[model samples]
Target: MTCQRRIVSCLLVGISLGLLFTPALGREVSDIKPANPNLCPKGREILKYFQSIYGKRMLSGYNVYVHTPDDYEQTGMLAAIWGRDVQWLPPVDEVIAHVKAHGYLLTLHWHWFFGGDSAWKSKRKTPVNVARVVTPGTPEHATAMKEMAAAADILEKLQEAGIVVLWRPLHEIDGGWFWWTDLDRPENTAELWRMMFRFFTEERKLNNLIWVYSAGVGDLKKKPVELRKRFYPGAEYVDISGIDLYGVNPAEDEEPYWTFFRAMAEVSPGKMLALGECDELPNPQKLAAGRLPIWLYGLPWWGTPSARRPVEQAIATMRHPFVVTLDELPAFGDEDPPPVVGILSPMDDGSAWFPEGSVTVEGYAVDRRGKVVRLEFWANDQLVGQLANPPRQFRWQWTDAPSGCYDLRAVAIDDAGQRFRSNRIHVNVGVVDAARGRPVTASGGENPSAAVDGNYYTSWRAPTEAEEAWIMIDLGQVHSIHQVNLIWGWKIHAEHFAIETAKEAPSQAASWHRVYEGKNLPWEVWKATHRARFAPTEARYVRIHFFRRAARQTWGGYDLAAVEIPIPPSKGAE
Candidate 1:
C-alpha cells in the first residue's frame, strides 16, 4: 500500500481502538458530571481567586477564538492569542472543527451586527433603541424578539454540536454607537438583558451556553452601575464577566485600567475572565510615527514587539484562572485542503503625491490535485477587475487609485479557470508632500546603511558616546512625543547604546531628556535592559549615544533596525 494510505489506515485503527477500549484506553465518554460548584453563580468570589493565580501562571485547557479559516492556518502553538471573527451568520460546524483540531475551549462571539457596524443592521444606519424591546405591544419590540430568536437558534446549534458557547453579545453596551446600549436610562439596559436571557435559556434551552458579559475599558461611572444592576438579569444567566480596556498609558497618574476589571470581577466572580477584544492602543507620537493614512484608533496590521508592552501589562495578571494557550493543541491541519496564496496591490507607500501608472499582482494557486492556476483580480471578491496579463511585476499608476488605503489582492486560475485568492497586500496611496524630503544618510560606519522596501526606504545606523548620530524629524505639525525607542540591532552588548531627545532648535532652551541608559552586560537581542517613562514633550531632535560595545563582543560595531515612537495619549483615550 502507498505510504499515504498506510498512514490513513493507522489513524483509523488507532481511533477505533481508543473508542472501543474507552476507560481501559484512558478515555471517558458517555457520562455527564455536574460542573464545579464554584462555577459562575454560586462561587463568584472564589472563581476570582482562581483566576488571579491562573493568570499569573500558564493555563492548561482554554481555547482562543479563531474567526477565520486563515486564523488557524497562519498561527503556531505558542502564539497564546486566539480570535474568532464576529460574523453575523452561525458558524457551528466551523467552531466544532476548530475545537477538535486545536483542543482549546471555544467562545462563540455573539456579534450584534454585520462587520461590527450598527449601520448595516436590518435598518441601515438607523439608530435602534434597546428600551423599545421592553414595550411588549410595539412592533419594534416584536422585531427585537425575532432577532433574539435568531441568536437563540445559533445557541441551539452550538449546543447540539456539544460545544460550550461563550455567549458575549452586545459588547461595549456603554458605547452609544451600538444598538444594545442605553445611555439615557440605566434602567432600560436591564430590559434588553432579560430579553436575551429569556430567548437563549427559555426558548432555545441551551444549558451549555456560558454567558460572558463584556464592557468597555472607559470610566464605569459613565456606564453607571445603576444601569447594570437590572442588567445582570440574574446569576443563572452569566458564566464569566470581563471588561475590554484599550487604554494606552502606563503612567501611574492615570486611572489604572485594571481597576475597571477588578470592579467587574467583584460584581461577578464565578465566571471566566477574558480580554474580549484588545489591541495595542497607540499614543500620539507612535500614531504619527506609523504615518497611518487614516485617523483610525488601532493598527490594522500585525502588532510589533516594540508596541506590545501595554497590551501585555493590561492583561498582566488574571484574577480567576480559567486559562487557555494555543501550544497545547496539535497542528490545526495535516491533510486538509492545500492553502491558496494571493498578493494585494497598490504597493506604493503613502507619501506618493501621484499614483504609479499601473500595478499588477501575481498569485500561484496549488490545490489537492497539485495543479497550478493563473487567476484574475476580483474586486470586492466579485467582479473580475482584470484578466491578469502576466505573472511578473504588476504595476498600477498612482492617479488611478482612490487616494487612500486600498486593499490590493490577486488570485490564481487553474487550467479549468478556477480561481483562488493569493495573499493580500495593503496599499497606501496618497499625495506626496513637497516640503517633506527624505533624510540624507549622514556619515555612518560600514555596518549600517539605508535600504528600500517597495515604495518606502528606511535607514539604520549607529552612534557612539563619542560619536552621536543626529537625525532630523519634521512632524509636519506641532505635536508632543512622550515615548521613543531607539532600535539596537541584535547584539548581546546592545546596552552600549543610549538615547537622548532634544528640541530641533538649540536656540529654544535645551529641552532634552536622556530617555535610556544602557546596561553594560551581555544580553540577547530580544531582552530589553534600558527603559524609562517620560513626560510628554514637543521636540524634533533625537540623538543616539553609544558608550561601549559588549565585552568580548564580535563585530565590534553598532547595529540598529528601526526607530519606533509612540504617540502621546489622546485626552480621553488614555
Candidate 2:
C-alpha cells in the first residue's frame, strides 16, 4: 500500500481501537491548562497552587538586587536571588536556610559570566568566545567546570537543606550582548546546553532543583524559531519555559508579550511558563481578569534605591486576589500527600508501527509532595528500560524488537515510595513513513523555495545587482505570527532589512505594515541568523525587504539560507 493508504489504515485501526494518537501541534493560549500532575508532582503542585488563585490573585516575587536579606520580611513577597550574588552575601546554605525559615518560595537566577566575574567589563565590552567554555576537552571548559563545580557546591548545600529551588542559569543566551551568548559557536550551543544539564543533574546529583530554561525578548525579536530551537535544552532538561523582559511598556507590548508566551507554550508543551525576570510588573487588573496566559509565576529584578518602585505598589500587587504570596502558600510536607502518577504519552492502548528495529517510549510522571525517583518501561511484563531521577518527561529506547504486537506500560516510583503505573499501550512492528507539513511559498529569490525546503546548505538569493528586493511568504491561511527567523546565506549578507505583514498580498498601497526593522546587523558569513518578534499579529502574508548588502570582497546580494515562522496552535489543536 502507498504511504497515504497505510496512514489511513493506521488511523482507521486506531479509531476502532479507541486510541487516536495525534501528532504534537501548536497550542492556543485559551487551551493553556495545568500540566498533568503526575509528570512533576512538586512542579505541578507549585503550578496548581498558583493556578487555583490564577484569576483571583498574583504572586509577589522580589530579587536580591543588593544584600538586603530583610527585604523578604519587608515586602512579604517570594524571594529571588542571583547565584553570583553569593560573592557578596552570606554562605549559600545560610541564605537559603534563612529564606526557607521565613516561609518564602525561593528561586535563583544566574547571570553566569563564564570567562570573567561580570557579564561586562565596561558598558558594552563583553568577553568573547564564551561558548568554547562549555565545549568539552578545552582549557576554557576546564575553567568553566571548575567554576561550575564551585557553584554546584553551593547548590548542593541547598539540596541538603531540602530547599526546592527554581534555578534559572545562563539566561538570555540568545542575545549577543551577554558573554555566554552562543554567537561564536551557535552550532555547538546545544552541546553546551546538554553539558550543563548533565553536570547539574548527573555530576552534582542535585535533586532540589527545578530547572528553568530562559531567554530574552530582545533575542526573540531577532530569530524566534532558531532562538528556541538552538538554545532549548529540550523538555526533559527544562521544568519551566521562561522569558526575561526589562523596561517593558505593557500597554504597547501586550501582544508581543502574549505572543512570546504562547510561542513558548507551543514549543514546550506541558512545561509551566513563567516571566522569569522583568523590571516592570504587568497590570494587576489585566492579570486578575485572565487577560493573559495563566503564568506559573512572575519575578521582578532587584530594586535599588536608584531605580526602585514604591514598596506600597509592590505590596499591593502581591496582595491582589490573583497573586500568591509566601504567607498564603499551602503547607506541603505532611499536609500534601505523595502525588498520583500517570503516563502522558504512548497513550493508553495506543500503538505504533516501527519496522526500523527501534522505538522510543516516552511519557511523564508527577507527584505533589515528593520527587519522582525512577521511571520503568515494561514490554510484555518484562522491564525494557528505566530512568533514575528523570525529568518530568521520560524516554526509553527499545532496539531490535522482534516483529510482533506487544503490550507496553510505564511504572513510576516517587521518593515517598509510592508507585504508579501507566495504562498499557499496544505496539505493532512494521514499516513507517515520515510525515511532512505543507511547503511555504515565497515571492522572489533565485530559488525562493529553497528557503523553506528544509535543506540548510541550499539558499535563496536575490539577483546579484538588485540593490533593493523583497521576499514574501504565504502561510496557507491567516496566522497569529509570534516569531520569524531569517537564516543568512554562507557568503552573501544584508546589513539592513524590514519585516512587514498583511492580510492580503503585500504592496506599497496595500495594508502591509512594518513590524520589525533590522539595522547594522552583525556580519558573520553563515554564522549570523536574525530573529524578529512582534505582538501576535494575524497575517496571511509576511514580507522581508532588504535594502543594503554588507560590503564583501566576493558576490554582492541579499540571500537567506532558510526562514521559519512559528505560530501558536489553534484551539483544540493537538
Candidate 3:
C-alpha cells in the first residue's frame, strides 16, 4: 500500500481498537477542554504537555527535596514532575527554589495528620468511615476544610507566579490501610474526592491546580479491577488517572503496572495516566520489553533507592530514549507558539507488526507562526527518515526491522530552522502474530475476539466451566508454524491445556491432532507467558484445548500469538 493509504489504515485500526485508547484520542486530546473548565492557563499548558506525550513518552519524576533521584546524576536526571507532601506545606520560597526556578511541574500530596490519626502508623492504618470528613457540620469536616484552605492558599501563590500545581488529595482511598478511607465502600471514597473538587474549584476558585485522582497498590493485589470504577470520582472531577505503584519488583512483578494501566483505562477512558508515587522505576530494557508505557509522568516516593530501583536502574530508566527528563521537557514559560507535532501511527496502545513485512509510519504536524518545512522520524533518537511537508499528511515507510522493541519519535523542523517534537512512542515489530485481528471462537466465553486484539488489557475469557473450555483462531490460509505464546491472566490461569492445529475445520474431535499439552504446569506460569513450541507444522487453524481449569480460579483473561519459525529449544519446549 502507498504511504498515504497506509496512514489511513493505521488510524482506522487504532480507532477500531478502542475510542478510549490514547492513540484514538489523537490531537483532539490536546484541544479538548480541561476537566476543570476553570483551569488556569499554566495548568492547562502542563496538562496539554502531558497529553501530547501520553503513550509515547514517560516523564521521570522524584519527590522534591527527597534527594533520591540525584543518584542518577551520572547518566540521567529526572525532574519533569516535582512532588512533595503537604505536612506543614513547603515554604513558598523553597517551592520556588526547587520547582519554579528549575521550570519543573509541581505536584502536592497531602498526608493529613487527622488529629494524629496517622495512616502510616503500622497498627492504626485500618480503614475509617471518614464520614465526618466528607459530611458537613462536623468537627472532622471543619478540620479537613481548614487543611484544604491552607493548601489552596499555597496553590494560589504558585498561580500568581504562572506556576502550576497537580493537586492529588485523598490518594489511595481504597487501600484500607489509609486513615481517611471507606475502603471496600468506594462510594464513600468518591464522595470525598468530589468534595475536595468542589472546595478547590468552586469555592476557592483555585484554577492553577490540576486534580489528580490516584489509586493505591493495596487493591491491585487483592480486589477485582471492577473496583477501579467504583473508586473513580468520575472524569469531570479528574484531570489525570493515577496509580501509586510501590512494593513490587519492576523486573519480576510487572503485572501490577499493566493491571493498573488497563484498570484506569476502563475506569476513566481518555484521561492522562500517571504514576503518582512509586518505589522503583523500570529500566530501559524492561521498557523495551513492551510491558509498560504511557505513564505521562511519575514520582518516586520519598525513600532511598534499593534493590527494586538501583542507581543503575534509575539511570537507565531516566536515560531511556523516550523518557522526558529534566532537560528535555518543553519550556512551560514560553509564550510564543511553536509548531505542534504528533505521531499518528503505530498506535502506542498496542499495535504490533511482524518483521516479515514492511510497516508504514506517519505523523501530524503544524506551525502556528511559521511554515513547517519538514518532518523527521527518528528511532532510538537516530534520524531514520524525513518527509518534506507532504501535500497532505506526514507519511514514512518503515521496513526491515528485527524482532525487538523500538523507541520511535518525530520532529518537525520549520522554515526558520526551529524544531518541534512529538512525544516518543514505542512500537513492536515482533515475530509474526498469526492470530492478530483474525477470526476467533471459543467454546463459551465473553469477548472471544479480545484474545487476538493485540492488546493484553482485553482478553478472551473462557467459560466459567468446571471442565472442557477451549479457544481457537483461524489463520484463513495454511502456513508453517512452530511456536505459540499464551499471555495468561492473573489469578485465573490455565493449569492443564493442549495445543492443536488443523488445515481445515475438523468435523470431529478425534480428527484434531494434539501438538502440545501442558499438564501440571509449574506454578511459575501464573503471571508470565506460557510458550509451547513444536516441529514445523502446516495448518490454517490453531486451537488451545483446556481439559481442566485451576481449582482455585476460573478460566479468565487470555491472549494468544503464534509465530512461524524454526525450532528453538531454549525459549520453550518442542
Candidate No. with top TM-score: 3
lDDT of 3 by residue, 101-163 (tens): 345577888886765567553555443457767889988788778877887888777777667
**Model 1 Cα lDDT, one tens digit per residue, 428-544:** 333222113323243355323231111122324444432334333333344455544443433423546655666555335466667666556565442122333367665555445
Rank candidates, lDDT, best first: 3, 2, 1
Q: What would the TM-score be for candidate 1 when compared with the true structure?
A: 0.41
* Candidate 1, residue 468: lDDT: 36
Model 3 gets an lDDT of: 0.64
Query: 145-221 in candidate 2: lDDT tens per residue?
Result: 98788878887887666566777777775656666666645546656666777887777777666677777676456
Q: Clashes in model 3: which pairs?
A: 56-424
After superposing candidate 1, which stretches have Cα over 4 Å from the reference?
A: 1-81, 85-91, 114-124, 221-230, 249-255, 269-272, 280-324, 328-574
Q: How many clashes would you count in candidate 3?
A: 1
Model 2 weakest lDDT span, ten residues long = 20-29
Q: Report lDDT (CA) for all predictions.
A: 0.42, 0.58, 0.64
The residue ranges of model 2 lying beyond 4 angstroms of the native Cα positions read 1-57, 67-89, 121-131, 219-221, 250-253, 304-308, 334-574
